[model samples]
Target chain A: MSETDLKLPLDAWHRAQGARMVSFARYEMPIQYEGIIAEHRWTRESAGLFDVSHMGQLVIAGRDAEWGLEALLPADLAILKDGRLRYSLLLREDAGIIDDLMVTRRGDHFYMVVNGATKHGDIDHMRTTLPSGVVLDHMTQQALLALQGPKAVDVMARVAPGAEELTFMTGGGFDIGGVRAWISRSGYTGEDGFEISVEARNVGDVAALLVAQPEVKPIGLGARDSLRLEAGLPLYGHDLDETTTPVEADLTFALSKRRRESGGFPGVQRILTELDKGPIRKRVGLFVEGRQPVREGALVVDAEGSEVGKVTSGGFSPTLERPIAMAYVPAAAAVPGTEILVEQRGKIFKAEVAQMPFVPHRYHRKGASA
Target chain B: MSVYFTKDHEWVRVDGDTGTVGITDYAQGQLGDIVFVEVPEAGRQVDKGGDSAVVESVKAASDIYAPVGGEVIEGNAALADEPSLVNTDPEGEGWFFKMRIADPSELDGLMDADAYRAFLADQ
Candidate 1:
């Protein structure tokens, strides 16, 4: 729409492939290609390439970059080693979450990836909180591509052999078709995949090279939402917000053990109290009984038809072949297999608090049973 | 036999007292990858244009309207588990349901194949 609205490096290529595109987070993005279910299953079984260049990438460089970031976020960034990625949560003064982001340590600089929709606010918060010496450089010239699914490793090996040695949640620089790029073995799809940060100029060519592989198909936001939902990952504006705390969102594990003990991060008082006293409500997984799906903002009721909680996210889980959802319910009712009711329209449907993910996550981690 | 269509994208074929009902191919294309079909129960009375069934896809849900006044006699039960059939063969195995005609004159208000094609172009 506007000149400032970001476009992915493969925008034209996506349109040429008959992708149905829409404006999401100020970027023209493909909602689906071929079909949502087909692309979804392809990502699970083979590979799917996604244009995530819309997400904001910034580099915070300074003499005390880790400590500078720790002053704003609720995680102990000092423990984060170079090349390793750590999930961190930005918090407001009231202990509520501002945004959840990935922080990567690169020498004296911390590479940060924040949600596309909240990038501007997150940058402002970082600039205002961190000292003047810390420079927040937004990498708007870079295009991020996510090559996800089981076959991603082999696809990456063909272009950048150095990518194979990089373990999960680690990133490094390498040559991708002679174009230098930052590649990470991390993704949001709950599958083994890689996220490549390439220069905007060469993004289209590199994406074409990757998608040309027989196993690599182009996916869109429709499947991306279902995949993340099945994986039990939180969507920023929906499942998390400024009023929800990291502990209440079930993301307390993102805080390192040393940070938990030291309690020096933002909103540490309320967060540590919630961690010890337990949150009043907790986010839980819901397995619907029938084919009828429940959606967001639906009322969650107890057995007596009394409203107790609300569904934050719900949909038909393609991987599970049944409908599943996530809701924030009373901690007493958040146990696995606890029965809850979801009301859509005027009818009430039966649902259970099932163990997440609705489908098992296949993250590439060391000592994994897979 | 004369084939007619409703503005809601439902097609009906009429011959004497019997008429067949199905969604148009254009409607199926718009509702990508139909995953669930809620067919009207047999023995239910229907109107010339009313909600008769529902088709759910990964993206959205659509209501199927009856093209002619009739009482449902049989439904395509195969679609309950395999709704994608609607995408593959919307006019054949994907037919929603068959009904006994309650009023044959209701077909006169519906559009024929040529008019329906013209109507789609305007859309």
Candidate 2:
């Protein structure tokens, strides 16, 4: 581990639970406890509690907070109901993505969560672009945790009681064993879950309380990565960067209809044009024929052995029992069932373009009959 | 048959001119889960400490080098269908390959069971 790396509030608690910590986003975080596959299966079957404190949690408030945020992002904030969340992208002037984040309209302010590695740069960009009257507070004193999987709601019903009332993409405050936490009914995993925001000092107490239950086991980043990959979620700096546009990243749904017509957000002209005409290249999923995984930096090659595109995120999917990946290929090859060749480590593997969310997402959407 | 261990965590069991190779249990335990293993084909010549095969876990891939220079006679086909054998039984059925020992003096540089145990403890 690097000497300059930061430590999480539950660093000692992770060690006590036999977590094998690894460096991730400059933080010494747990990569696995028992093992990646076991933890992944446990999360799919039961519940897995994850420490996600490294991600940046910010509160944006001021007069016209919604208006200020709408200028920087593409979400239709005016129509977003209170207590509802929208996934959005921070865009550069020329239509490049600064970061992808989730924005929630609370009572008077907005709560935003961005990626860990790009938080500092995101803060700098927003500070410079936003108006002088607007306020952005980085909630560094808070710690975040996610309780995910099929049994997460069951665990929450016993601990927090009212968590079941909230559905996907919504959040509310609750008292969990006397600790006040802002619990959101959402997560990166395709399964149903909650993201709990609590005081940094009380994270250990919250973690201990949840794991003490029979259904919840403390998971690590290794399983977290595999779960998100199966969910087809793009990870910043891996599947997304400043050079990638939201349309090319297959995230045009983040651009609201009203905003597309109004054309006020950053890079609206280029983004709107691409949304109409279609991008030259698109991000798509890949299904490898063999057990060997093709990881990031592997090239998508053509029949003549020339590089066409690159693989972003890939691994052996414990859930699917096969290798899956995400890559950027020419728009003509982005359709499902189209074949592509991936070259890695001096060997070539035949792959096909497959629909994303390789495993079906089991999110508990509101009004969906169970 | 005599078994010898290398500092890189490979083991070679020798009987006359034939040698069976695999990683040690300690090495497999450190590598976590074994997802894939690629071994060289028969008749391929490998030098001592050269990259001869590959073993991939969920997190990353690692090279399994030849413990002693030899010509590969056979690869363990069982690993292709079930890679977890390396984690379950690394020194037994999980043996990666069999080769004809090209240099008998190369075995002298390896460690015996007692010395390997000491080396693992030091690590």
Candidate 3:
């Protein structure tokens, strides 16, 4: 680890488990334990534990907090029900993405989680924009862990009996092993899982308890990236940046109906215009023809070999047993079955635009079968 | 026949004027979960230390350099279907390609097994 690289609360434990550590978001994080592919498969088949403590957790409280937050984000936070989580994007003045985040209403206050790499900037941006009455508290003493997979609910039920009651995108405070924790039935992987927030000091006990289950193993960042990629969820720095808008990034679903109608948020004109007319370039999924993985930054080309766009995320999907990628392309070429080419390392391969979540999501929504 | 290693962790086994090449075990270990391998086509001439092949893991891709100048003879066809063979049996069935050695003197500068182990230790 470098001198400036911070370590997670479970850093020592990860090293003890023989995790390959890498620098991510200024933190020395475990990239893989057994291996990326194996861990990814395990997460899909069984439960895999992830240490996501680097993500920034914040609490926004005080009167008019929701309205204050509404000005900077596209989501209608005022209508968000208590104990429900909604994925939202922090937008800049020009409607470009500042960062994508999760905001959960906790009755009187809002609990928000932002990407690790952009948390500090996000905090600064919020602090500067929000009214003086609203308070922003960065929850530095909390550690977040994700227990994700098909068996995740079973494992969570085994430890915290009533945790299974919380459906997808729902969270509430619960007690596990006598430790106070806030858990949400949500995850980046397209699986039924829970993200638990615990006190930093007691996080190790919670992690130990979860991994002790026969169905659970410690997964690392490598599998996390591949899992999200396979699920068609975009990484912030790679798929989303300050240069891209939510409409262009295929995240217009996060724009609430009320927000779309009233249009009070920053860059509302541009966003509403793009939403109505459609973006010039849109994010789309590419299914490569062969075994070769077309990685990020590879050029998307037309039949004439003219560059149209660039790949943002690409990898071999263990589930699909082929190479898959997500990239931005001209609106005309964004339709499924549109043939395109990916150029990488001086080699060109045929690719086709496909609908995403390349794998179906298994979220345990309310009233849905387990 | 003798096996020689390069500082970049590739190995070449010389049998007469033909040298069979593949990445070292350490190289495969460093690159977890080999997903794809791109090899130079047969009849292509390569220079010493030039990019000879490409190995891709789920996370990143790396170039496999030619330890010495040679003309490609054949690439392992099995890798196109199962690249993990490079991780499972890196030295035996996983050999990447066979090349016709350009100059016999190039082998003299390569490392023996003992020297290669020492080089790894130094790293």
Best by TM-score: 3
Q: Model 1 clash pairs? A: none
Q: On residues A1-370, what C-alpha lDDT tens digit does candidate 3 reach at each position?
A: 6789999999888998899999999999999999999999999999999999999999999998999999989898877899999999999889989999999999899999999999999999999999999999999999999999999999988898789899999999988878999999999999999999999999989988988899999999999998998899999999999999999999989999999998889878888889889999999999999888998999998878889999999998988989999999999899999999999978899999999989989999999876
What TM-score against the true fold does each predicted structure earn? 0.92, 0.98, 0.99
Residue A370 in candidate 1 has what lDDT?
Answer: 42
> After superposing candidate 1, which stretches have Cα over 4 Å from the reference?
A1-6, A367-370, B15-20, B43-50, B65-74, B99-110
Candidate 1 C-alpha lDDT tens digits along B1-123? 888898889988777787889998999877777777888889999887788988877756677889888899888888887888899999889989989998887888889999999999999
Clashing pairs in 3: none
Comparing to the true complex, what docking class would candidate 3 get? high
After superposition, the stretches of candidate 3 with alpha carbons farther than 4 Å from their true spots are none
Rank order (by TM-score, best first): 3, 2, 1
Look at candidate 3 and tell me the lDDT of residue B7: 91
Say which prediction, candidate 1 or candidate 3, comes out ahead on lDDT: 3
lDDT of 3 by residue, B1-123 (tens): 999999999999999999999999999999999999988899999888999999999888999999889899999999998899999999988989999999989989999999999999998
User: Over the stretch A276-328, how does candidate 1's per-residue lDDT look in tens digits?
Assistant: 99989988889988786777888998778788888898777788888788899
Worst 10 residues of 3 chain A by lDDT: A155-164
Give the winner by TM-score: 1 or 3: 3
**Each model's chain A TM-score:** 0.96, 0.99, 0.99
Worst 10 residues of 1 chain A by lDDT: A1-10
DockQ list for all candidates: 0.49, 0.76, 0.87
